[model samples]
Target: MTITLVQGLLIALLAMITGLDCWLQAFFIFRPIIVCTLTGLILGDLRLGVIAGGLTELAFAGLTPAGGTQPPNTVLCGIMTVVIAATNNTSPATAIGLSLPFAMLMQYILLFYYSSFSLFMSKFDKYAAEGNAQKFKRLNFVPLIIVTLSFGIFAFLSAYAAQAPMHALVNSMPQWLTHGFELAGGILPAVGFAMLLKVMLKPRYFPYLLLGFVIASMISFSNVLPVALIGGVFAAIEYFRTREVSDLKEQIKDIDNGDDQDGI
Candidate 1:
């Protein structure tokens, strides 16, 4: 489907806001899952958008930015996943794989933008030396505005120009290749789960994880809301249980200290 210019602009604006939240705002509205769902809603395919977004979230869950190093571009990956899936009738896995390269490219683009923006540091120094608060604040915002605008332009291009090429590529794929991609996509989420477990698993949480798995096994895959609710309840229980334990320990310490004072 061809995106109208106005729709394209709206999408670009959404992308800019989403990208800005990723680092600048620290709000999670720009996460891969959320971005994918939003893109899907915009393109008239919310189901595909949600599935792709959720799978992509799992795939990237183990990654995070660390000092000078940035993770792969989740915003780009999420947008491309929804776009490809909506336009090309591709499996989530195929769309995910297809979007990986572009996500990497976005990472490089961000790096370059940051590096180039650093050239303005001398201007910041001048403003600080002059005690010009207005200029300093404006200079501080320059990188944010530029980066946000760049993300919007990239989103617009993807929404507008990517359809034809992606359609052509999908149409040319052999049946076996298509089936293979579907199979790969089906397993991709497991990889994401494994990676997440690797990072988040601790001896203390092992029992909780096992309990979740056991409860999840009894439910059908189509029903997730129940599972989520049960998990939330268990999490709350654990939180309160831990808090009580800590409070008891603190009281016991207070009593021991009081006894020592009485002896003195």
Candidate 2:
């Protein structure tokens, strides 16, 4: 709970790094689990980080930002969740419960930040259009640093500030409301995921997604065979299958063309 300023800053730095371009093959911050754990180590609470990351991972297990679909704010949640759980000695349920709104807020901060910076993106666009490649490349770092530093500052402030409010809120709240917030935290993000599904999920593929949940539950592999992993695997298969179908159709067209030539 009582982290030194040096320790606190390191966590913020790590959070910024994870939140930054960490968009791996498909997602930003694939390193939250690792980042959060390292942060806990610095904060003198490794176990808290591990447990928080594990639970938070599941809450966000289904929410991957694939293209235009916005996911829950992993940006802040990664470090913030760890801080709350570690500082307050909260359980995964409590910590995970706390992470959702923060994550949602982060999503919009990013969206608005993106939109605002997009004004500059037009500048980049102009340079790109003009074939001013050097200027275009140099201009790119501006937004990158801005986003990274924003998260870094946010994490630093939240680590210290969140302690007071969260402690006060928990102490002052009636048991019922506190419990309700916990439950709502778990449930609220389904709306986000639904938004994501509405955008990216293929109707025909819903069955497979359901099957994934069923299979994981049946085998008691809830965390392991998560919806995101299942969805990603399915997405990959669909991609290849769609390509294969296109190739076959093209081959058929070519054969038909040859037949027409022979007839002539």
Candidate 3:
């Protein structure tokens, strides 16, 4: 499907908004789940967007910026996954692998931005020393604007300007290579989940994890709502149980303090 100019503009607008949000860490609308859904909406393929979003979100679940380290760019991954899938008439899985280069490109762009912006630090200090609050505030927005504009430009180029070439390239790929991409895409989500488990899985939580695995494997449903509901129930139980334990500890401490006062 050909991407109309209006659609391209809308995608660019969305990219700008999410890019700013990512820089500000204000709203997490930059996440793949939100970004992909919005991209799909703009592309007039809500179902495709939703499916791609789910897969992409999982693949990125364990990835986050830490200190100076940046993971693969989530916003580009989300947008291009949907855009490629829609434009090239390909599966979301295949599109995901195809979108990796774009995501990596954005990652490098952001890293360059970060390094380039550091050169302004001395100027920032100078403005602060001179008590120029206005200048300081304005200077802060320079990087933000540059980042936002870059996102819009790149998204427009990839989604619209280069659509024909990308479509041709996708169509020219061998069946085996396309299948390889699909297999890789399918495996990435599990790898992401394993990464998360490595950090978060505790002995006490193992039973719940095992239970979830068993339920998911043994049962078949039209959708995942039932599994989500069950997980919610387990989460609630854990929350209340932890609260009760905390309350008991507080009560015991209070009683001990009272007994010590009486003895004194």
Range of the 10 consecutive residues with the lowest summed lDDT in candidate 1: 61-70
Off by over 4 Å in 2: 22-31, 125-133, 185-196, 200-203, 221-264
User: Better model by TM-score, 1 or 3?
Assistant: 3
For residues 3-27, write the lDDT of model 2, one tens digit per residue. Answer: 6688778877876777775532234
Model 1, range 1-264, lDDT digits (tens) per residue?
A: 656677677778888999888757588877789999998888778888899888888777655664235767889889887887777777877888777777888788888987798799899999999999998998888788888998899878876767678788878988888787767656666755565676678898898778778888987776567777877998999899999999999889889788756644
- The full ranking of all candidates by TM-score, starting with the best, is 3, 2, 1
**All candidates in order of lDDT, best leading:** 3, 1, 2
Clashing pairs in 2: 73-103
Q: Residue by residue across 1-264, what tens digits does model 3's lDDT show?
A: 899999999999999999889888898999999999999999899999999999898788777774235878889999999999999888998899999899989999999998889899999999999999999999988998999999999989988898899988999999999999988888877756666677779999898888888888889986667788998999999899999999999889889788756644
Q: Which residue pairs come into collision in candidate 3?
A: none
- Mark the regions of model 1 whose C-alpha exceeds 4 Å error after superposition: 2-10, 25-27, 32-34, 41-71, 91-93, 111-131, 228-237, 258-264
lDDT of 1: 0.80
TM-score of model 1 (CA atoms): 0.74
> TM per model?
0.74, 0.76, 0.81
Minimum summed lDDT over a 10-residue window in model 2 is located at: 22-31
Question: lDDT (0-100) at residue 199 of candidate 2?
Answer: 71
Q: Which portions of model 3 show Cα errors greater than 4 Å?
A: 4-6, 44-47, 62-69, 222-224, 247-264
The residue pairs found clashing in candidate 1 are none
